[model samples]
Target: MIKGIYVHIPFCHQICSYCDFNKFYFHNQPVDAYLDRLDQEMEHWSRKTDLSEVHTVFLGGGTPTSLSLRQLSKLFDSLEQHFPIHQITEFTSEANPDELTYDKMELMAARGVNRFSIGVQTFDARLLKVLGRTHTEQHVERVIQHANDLKFPSISMDLMYGLPNQTMDHWKDALHRAFQMPITHISAYSLIVEPKTIFYNLMSKGKLPLPAQDLERDMYDYLLTSTKKHDFEQYEISNFAKNGLYSKHNSIYWKNEEYLGLGAGAHGYVDGIRYSNHGPLKKYMSALEEGNLPIIHQNFVTEKEAMEEELFLGLRMNKGVSFSDFKRKYGNDLREIYQSQLSKQIQLGNLEERDGRLQLTYQGRFIGNDVFSEFLL
Candidate 1:
């Protein structure tokens, strides 16, 4: 069953230095045409799947808040037409702190958007400039205040560490400022210099002075400790939430369940086939114009591949993978299939079987990639 719906808004007011997502600048583009095509795509999917079963709908970026009020309304109108917007338990829209105005927030709230995931990479002005972010600390404060005033059920912030010239003290300061906000959740990630990004070019030229590996580790350690102190539970490896306010949409992905991915450059996994849509706006719209799905590439997941994914993706959660759930899903004993790897990790003290759940230990999270790789049969 498709438990979630993820709509991609591939337009950003300003492109960040380290971002490699499929997005374009928001100026002089066919914004209305794109929204129209997006609506067409949703209409097409609605014919094939029962969208009413979808419990969560996530509006991810570029920046969903980059749209004008009218554009947002048009998009919401389409969403309501195809899906039960009010029935969705968690409706989240990713926002840029500078772009999310008071009126926009009101429109989103009226449209049943219960969560705002603001992109506030860092509180430091120098770091914001380095990251190509236009929002200031004050902008973030005002946005949070507005969301609170409107009484949004859940407000979340995305933060990044290990940026160019970032120090331990810088990371600590960002965390402190983040805890001060009236947010229910925080998703913090370390910077990775992906190809085709400004950071990648600078890294190639030795111009990006990133923090050392040890310092990055220390930053992550401090993050785990500090968020716990602030009464936020680490539900996922990088996601912390207060009062059990976990991101239900993201949890669908972690649990390896299927979802419908709409709009240009979106990806979806449905009926054991994982697929991504055409990224170019024209190509995406052209496919829909021809009454076809905009999928560009797809692969049918084999049973072996599914089991591998089950382990790696499920291990990312704090609860880890349930042995019984694995057996029920795959109809094989989890202990027999990856017995050697599980034993190796458990003996190494990186993993443990606690109450039939194979989970990562404190030591394992630091070397998570290395540990997860061992399960690839």
Candidate 2:
């Protein structure tokens, strides 16, 4: 079954310093017009693919909650026109706490959106100012409570570490705040200053005081210990979820399953063809208005590339990869394909195989990207 669909809404209230996502500062002209094209794109794509099998739909951002209820309803209405969408199991939308309102939450719930992911980067107002986040800690708390009151099936909060002027105590407080809600998932990510972000500019000017290497690692280790203590499973790198509450749409990406993506700057793969949408709203809308598919590029995954992706992504889970499933899917022995890397890692006590399961050792998980990089083909 086609188990995942991702729709990117590329508008945000304002740009954040640490962000480099495909987004524009919110504007009246572009936001309304972009939704129109997104509606058309969905209708056209439904005719292009047998989309009946889609089991989950995730509306991600920029910030999907930026949309007015009317805009969101129009978007959802367009989809219902083309597909039997009620079968979609996990419908999620990303929200920033400032954009979340009781009416918005209630409206989404009525429209079958069962999951919400709040972008609560930090509760520290000073840190939020540095991060260019518009919301406050109290906003996050209220939004979580509001979603719980609305009976959302899943609620998630996103946190970040390795910021300037952060301490272990601050991080611990943030984790504590996360637990105060009935949130089923929390994602904590390290702050990596990408070249395009405002942080990178400050860093280049030597105006930003970054945490030292030891402190960064300490942040990660602390989160690991704290989450496990709280009974939140560290399923993927930077993600903690309560049992069975792991993001179903995100799993499709990590598991390398087929999915369709619509809207500006979205990426998807199905039937071995991977493609991305045009990033600019003007470009996307023009193409859709002309009744043209807005895909800017595509690559057909070779069997070798597919197998390599499967291995790299599967290892992200704590359950690891089943040797039987690997062989069953690829028609090749896992031991043979990864023999050299596996042997070297096992000898170094970084990787192991036992009882038909292949996974990284505790030591290996810390350097997982290193292990994953070995399979890059």
Candidate 3:
């Protein structure tokens, strides 16, 4: 049973240095063609699954907001034909302020989009231009105000730290500015140089310097403390949400529930099988038009491997994994499976076993991946 759905729109206004997410610099010519294929895929999938059990739906992307109001309206029309639209609890779309205006927000609202996740990487105008962003800080403020005026159920902002040429103070300033807005959620990302990204090439050319290791660590420290100071709770490693506002769609993925992914480069998991659509836009459309699923690869998740995934994905949350859920799923106690590994981590203070549940300690949050890597057979 699929509990969630992810829609990927692989087009962005400008490429960022550290971003490796599947996206291409958007040109207007391909918009209609791409959405046409997306419509076909959604129609096919709607017939493929029952929509009764679906709980949450997310529209993610290179920047979904890049689509024109007309295009977005057509997309919502296609979505309604396939899924239980009113049954969806959370309907989120990733937007950029430059492309998102009052008209676009109102169109999405008219189509029942109740949640928005706008990218506001920083408030510094110079740094924003350096990052190749088209919008100014003022644009973000206006977009947020408009979304709030619509009475959207939730509004989230995305922020990044540890950027090239970013100082500790600059990082704090970004967080400070975002908190000043009426946001119910915040997603923080550390700058990572990814291959083929302009940011990666700049680092390779020595034209930009990454934050020092110690400074990066301190920046993360600042994130944890400042978010806490703002009365936000860190539900996942890089996600903070106000009370009862955690991202339900994302929580489904981390919880390892079966979900469907649509559009180019989107991934889906169902009945222990994991698969992804073709990454290339043209290739994806061609394959689907030929009546194929456009799937590039598929794998079966073994019982043992699914368990390991549970460990890491669950631990990414501050609450960690649940023993009751573990036993119910595997007919095996987690402690019995990873007895030594768990013991070693607990001794190192990276993990804690308390209150009939397991969770990561404070120090564990920083080095969590390291601890998890050891258990990834």
| 1-377: candidate 1 lDDT, tens digit per residue | 89999999999989999999899999998999999989998888888886657899999978899999999999999999988776799999999999999999999999999999999989999999999999999999999999999999999999999998898899899999988889999999999899999999999998999888999999999999999999999988999999999999999988999999998899999989999999998899899889889999999999999999988889999999999999999999999999899889999999999999999998898888899999887
Q: 93-158 in candidate 3: lDDT tens per residue?
A: 999987898999998988878889998888887778777887888899999999999998899998
- C-alpha lDDT of residue 239 in model 1: 95
Q: What TM-score against the true fold does each predicted structure earn?
A: 0.99, 0.97, 0.97
lDDT values, one for every candidate: 0.93, 0.86, 0.87
What's the lDDT for residue 344 in model 1?
A: 93
- Candidate 2, residue 336: the lDDT equals 90
Candidate of highest TM-score: 1
> Candidate 2's residue-wise lDDT over 1-377, tens digit each?
45678889888888999998888888765777887788888888787787777889898989899889898888788767866678989999999998989998998888889999889988889999999999987888889999989888899889999999888888888888788778999989989898889999999999988888788888889899989998899988778999769988888988889998888899989788999999988888899889898899999999899888887998887767888998999899988988888888789887788778888776777788888888775
For model 2, the local distance difference test gives: 0.86
Error of 3 at 335 (Å): 0.5
Task: Estimate the Cα RMSD of every predicted model relative to the unseen true structure.
Answer: 0.8, 1.3, 1.2
